[model samples]
Target: MNPGGLDYNYEDWTTIMNMTAKTSVLNLTQEEFIYPGNRACSGCGLSILYRIGLKALGRDCIFVVPPSCLTVMQGLFPIAATQMPVLNCTFASTAAIATGVRAAMKRLGRDTQVVAWAGDGGTSDIGIQALSGALERVEDIIYICYDNEAYMNTGVQRSGTTPQGTLTTTTPLSGKAEASKNIPAIIAAHNPAYLATCSASYPLDFHDKLLKAKEIKGLKYLHIQTPCPPGWGCEERMTVEIGRTAVETGLFDLYEIEDGQMKLSGPSQKLLGKTSLRPVREYLEMQVRFKALSDEQINVMQAEIDQKWAGYRDTF
Candidate 1:
C-alpha cells in the first residue's frame, strides 16, 4: 500500500514517472475550459493559473470552491465562467466537501477527479482543520491553495500566510509582525501521496504538476503563489512579472515532492548553483504593500533568503 493507504500499483508508478517530462508551451492544448467575460480583475494571476490548470485537469473533474475571489470570478447564479461543475462551500469546509464528493464518485463508479480550491486564508487559517483531517485520512482529492499573501477576497485582511512586513488592511501602519506560515512543510508532515509548490507566473509548470498529481491516488496538495494587483499595490499588468520576480528572488520556489522525494522544478532548478539571486528588495519595491519597509528590514529579508538557499544547496 502507498503512504496514503491506497493499493500501490507498480505500473501506475512507472507511468507517472514517464509522464514527468516537462510540457512545452507550444504543445499545450488549444482547448479553453474557462469562457471569456468573467468577473476576474485585469491581470489577475489566479486567472492565468486557473485557465492553464483546467486544461491539465480536462473535463473529467469536479471543483470544490469556498467563499473566495474565485467564487466571485466564476460569476453567480444563472451565469458562470467555467464549463466544469463547481460546488461552492463555506470558508472552512472545502476539503470536507471534496472528500464527500470523491466518496460519491467512487460509489457511482465514476473516476472524476475532485479538486478543492481556496485562497490562503481559507487554506492556512479557516480551513486547515478539514484539510489536515482529509490528508490524514488519505482522502482522494486534489487540494490547491493559491496564496496571494493577504485575504484579498474580503478587503485585504491579514491571513496566516501573509508575509512579515506586509501592509494589509489589518496590519496597516507597522506591517504584519509575525512570519508567514510554512504551509507546504506542514502539509508534508501528513505524508500525502503528492505535494508541490507552484507559481502563477509559470502556467505550464503548474499544468504539468497537476497532470502528474491526477495519476496519483489519495491526497495531492499544490500551493501556488499568486499575485494580487490592488492588494499588493502594483499595476494590474505587472501581476505575472511580480510572480516571476518572487521565484527569481527566492521568495517563492517551484518544486514537487512525490513518494517522499523532492525535486526542484525547471525555473528554480536553473537557479540552484547560482552565486546570488536577484535582490529581495527588487521584489519588495515592485509592490506597494512593502512601501513602509525600512532598509534594515529589507536587509534582514535578504539575509533570510540567502540563508534559505544555503540550506537548499546543502539538501539538493
Candidate 2:
C-alpha cells in the first residue's frame, strides 16, 4: 500500500455496494508469481492488475494468454515475465485453452487453477465464440479480459468494446459511430457463477473480487478496465488516475452479476447517483484520442453518456 493509500477506497465502496468482506488467512508459503521484468509500458494499468492477479491466483496457476499486448510483453518465447507456466495461444483461443488446461488438470488430479487472460478485442470480437463455448460448458476456469476498449496490441485499432464516439486507428479523429458491445451483460446472460467488472485503480475492490471469483465453483469472468498510455494517448504516470476517473464518471462501473441479479459495487456508485454526473469531456480530456471532437460532437457524446448512465442507475 502506498503512503497516500489505495486510490479508490474499498471500505467506503463496500458500504455503497451493500456487501461485506469475509476474513481469511493468507498463507505465506505461496510463491510470488509475477516479476517486474515484463515489457508493458510504464504505469500500465493492466500490468498492475496482472501483478495483483498473480498474488490472488498464486504460483500454482497456469495462464493462457492469447495473442495480445501481453504476449509481446511476456517476452518472445522461452522467457516470460511470469514465474508460473504460461501458455501462449492464438489470438482467439484463450478460453478454449483454459478449458482444455482445466480438464487436463482434473485428469492429473492437480489442483492448479487455469486462467484465460485476454484483451477486449480478443474477448468481445474475435474470441467471443471460444469464450462462449468455454462458458457454456461451465468450465472450471477464470476468464479475465483486461479491456483497454481497443485492439491496443495492433496499433490501437478500434474493437467492438471501444465506446461510441471514441477515436482509434481504424476510427481515427472522426470517432467510432457504432455502440460499444455489451460484453459483461452478454456474459451475465449465460448465468455463470460470477461476472464482475473491476479496475486497477481500486486495489481493495480488485482484490476482493478476485478472491470472490476464486471461491466460486464454475466459470468466472472479470472484465477489468485497463488504461493504456500509448494507446489512450495519456501520460504514463496517469494510468491509475485515468482508470479512477473512468469509473467515477460512469464510463465504467464496478459491479457484479450473479445468477441473474446485477449489483453495482464501488464507492463511485453513490457518487454517480448524484443528479449531475461529471461531463464526458472531463473524462475525454484526459486522453488525446478525443482531442479532435468538435463542440457539437461533444454535446452529442454527452447526451449519449447521460442516457447510458441513467439506464445503469435504473438497474440498481
Candidate 3:
C-alpha cells in the first residue's frame, strides 16, 4: 500500500504486472520502446504485449515486421509504433527476411537480437514456407506470431488459427468443419531452441518466456493469444479478460517446448488437471461468434474440446 492506496502491497502488484517499472528518472535513461503514438484500438491486447516485450528485450534489437494488422497499427511509411530499427518485408517472407538480418548481423560481428513479428495469417498460413526454411537452417532469430485468430487487417477473414463455430468472413455462422491449427506443435515439429504460447492475462509467464527466449541462441518462437474487439465482437475493455478466459477455460493453454520436450507454464494447467472440464459454452458466451450456435452445434464443439483437452492432458 505504498502510494496507490490498494489493499495488496505495491511490490505484489508489480509482481502481477510482471514488468520492471522505472522507479526513477535514471531508469528512463536507458532507451524507449514501442513508440507512444500509433493507431492501435483503445484496448488492444497486442499493443500491451508489444509494450512489455520491448521493455524486456530493450532497444538493442532489430525487428522483421511483415504485412498484417501490426503493419497497419504501426502505420504506413514515415510513421511506426516501434522505436527500434524495423525492417518491413513482404507478407510471406518475414522468416526469410529475419534470417537474412541475423546472418548480416553475424557477419558484421554485431550482437543484436533479430525478431520476426507476424500475424496468424502470415505465420500459420502464408509465411509457413519461409518460416520452415528459416527453422530448418536454425537461424538466430526470435519469431513471434501475435495470433488474433483471423486476418483482422483483411476485414476479419478466417485464418488457420480461427477456431471452429466462429463467424468470420469466410466461415460464417454455418460452422467451420476444420479445426484451428495447432501452431505450437507445428513449430515444435521443427525442433527449434524454444517455442511457447503466451497471453497478456498471464504477464509473468509471458515475461519469463521472453527472457528465456532471449537467452537462447537459435530460433525461438512464441505464439501469443491476442484478442481483437472488433474482430471478436467483444467490448474493448474485455480484451485482457478474454485472453485470461481463453487459458482458464482451456480454449488456449499456456505452454512451452524446449529441444523437443513440452511444458505447461501456468496454474490453470494444475486446476485443469484436477477438475472436470468446463463447458465450451462457458468460454464461447463472451464472444459473438457463438451467438448463432445451435444446441447441436454447441454439442459438437463440446465434444471437440473434450477430445482436444484429453490429448493435451496426455501430453503432460
Candidate 4:
C-alpha cells in the first residue's frame, strides 16, 4: 500500500485505462455515416445526434425524417449529408409512414431497420395522433424525437416539450407556462417494447440505447435532447457543454423502459438517490434563454426538479 493507505498499482491503472480505450473502439462501428459538406449550423447538437445515431443504426436502415430541421439539413433529394437512404415525410405523418415502410420491408423479408425521426413539435403536437396509432399497433419501427425544446426550424416557438420558464418566440417575456411534456411516460402507457431518453452529449450511451432498440421487435421510442444554437441563444460551441449540464443538474435524466419497467441508466442511475445532482442554476445560467430568471423562479425550478427526481426514485 502507498503512504496514503490506498492499495494501488501502476499495472492496475494501466490495464483499466487501456481497456477503456479498446472498449470504446469495440462498442462503436468504425463507419462514417455522414459525409463531409452539410449545411448544419456550427456546433449544432442535432447534427451530432444524427451523425452518431446513423452510425449506430448503420447503412442497412432506412430513415424517415419529417418536416424538421433534420429534413432541411439533409438537403433535397439525390444529394444529402447522410450516406444512407433517407425518406422525407409530411410533418404530421412521420410515424404512420414509418409503420407502412416497416410493413413493406417485412413482406419483402428484409431485416432492414426502419426509423422515424421527428422533432418535439411534430411528435408531441402535430403528429401525436399518428404516433399514438402506430404505438397501439406495435409496429416494428424505431421512432426518435430529437427534442430541441421548440420548433427551431419553423421559428423559436414554444413546443409541448419546452421546459417551464424558458424563453421562446411565443413565450418571449413570461416564458413557457407549463412544465415540459413527459412524452416518454405517455409512450410507456402503450406498453411498447422499448423506451429511452438519451442526450446528444452522451453519444456512446445513446448509441448503446439505439443498438438495444434495434434488437427489439415491437415499438421503440427514443427521445434525444439536442441543443439548438440559435434557438437557445447560447454560443455555438456550448452545445455539448449545455447538454451535459442539463443531465447533471437532474433536469434531464437518462433512463430505459422495457418489459413494463422503467430503470434509470447512465449518470441518472446514480442520481436515483437524493442529493446526487448539481445546482440547477449552473445549468440555467449558461444559456441566455434562462437569463431572465429571478430568485423565486430559481426556487420554483429547483422544487420542480426535486419533485421529479423524487417521483422517479419512488417509482423504482
Best by TM-score: 1
Worst 10 residues of 1 by lDDT: 1-10
lDDT against the true structure, each candidate: 0.90, 0.80, 0.79, 0.84
Q: Which candidate is the best by lDDT?
A: 1
Candidates in order, TM-scores: namely 0.93, 0.86, 0.86, 0.89
Model 2 lDDT at residue 213: 83
lDDT of 3 at 270: 68
Sorted on lDDT, best first, the list reads 1, 4, 2, 3
- Any runs in candidate 4 off by more than 4 Å, and if so which? 1-27, 273-276, 311-316
Candidate 3 lDDT by residue in tens digits, 1-316: 1243334332353353345432222221123466677888878877877877775565678989998877867767777676778888999999999999998999999989998999999999999999999999999899999999998988998899988767888888675557789888889888999999999666556666776788898999999999998898899988888888777766677878887777777745664565466666776888886676788888876787678777776766
Error of 2 at 44 (Å): 1.0
Superior by lDDT: candidate 1 or candidate 3: 1
lDDT of 4 at 198: 91
Please write out the lDDT profile of model 1 over residues 1-316, one tens digit for every residue.
1344443243453344356476655445556789999999898999998998987887889999999999999888899998989999999999999999999999999999999999999999999999999999999999999999889989899999999999999999989999999999999999999999999999888988998899899999999999999899999989989999999999798889888898888799889979899999989999999987899999999998899899988889
Candidate 4 TM-score versus the reference: 0.89
Give lDDT: candidate 2, residue 144.
92
Q: Given candidate 3, what's the lDDT at residue 294?
A: 80
| Residue pairs clashing, model 1 | none
